[model samples]
Target: MIKVSVLYPNSDELIFDKEYYLNTHVPLVSKLLGDSLKNAQVDFGLASGVPGEAAMYVVMTHMSFESLESFQAIFEPNSVEILSDIANFTNCQPQLQISEIQI
Candidate 1:
């Protein structure tokens, strides 16, 4: 399986709309991606390993797919709409990573 991680790094100046992300953005992505998306998980970071450090990211979304081709087929087509929705939620530019999921 392939796992795609969308990470929103945390910073002192960052603004993240967790409510919209959980309620609106996630569903929008799920609806757009359809069956090609095997599973989706969202994480809200609370803190870093260090006691007083802020969490690395404010939010991270993990998506599982059968293959990169399958993910791209839907993502590439609907990316415009999906990306545009970000402005309605947060101003943070998300970081992305793709990896192979083992077991």
Candidate 2:
């Protein structure tokens, strides 16, 4: 399996619409990706390892798929619509990463 992670950095100067992301954007992605998306998870960063340190990211979304090809086949076609919805939520430029799920 593979996991695609979308990370939004936490910053005092940046804005992240948690409500819109959880309510709107996440559902949109789930609908668009369909069965190809094996599973999905969202993380709201609270704090870092250090007591007083802030979390590195405001939000992170992890999506699981059978393989990279499976993800690309679906995601590529709907990329425009999915990406365009970002503005409706927040101004943060999300970072993306794809990793092989071990064990």
RMSD vs true structure, all candidates:
0.6, 0.7
In terms of lDDT, the poorest run of 10 residues in model 1 is 11-20
lDDT of 1 by residue, 45-66 (tens): 9999999898999998999999
The 0-to-1 C-alpha lDDT of every candidate, in the order given, reads 0.93, 0.95
* TM-score against truth, every candidate: 0.97, 0.97
Error of 1 at 99 (Å): 0.6
Candidate 2 per-residue lDDT, tens place, 1-103, comes to 9999999999988887789999999999999999999999999999999999999998999999999999999999999999999999889789999999999
Best by lDDT: 2
- lDDT against true structure, model 1: 0.93
Off by over 4 Å in 2: none
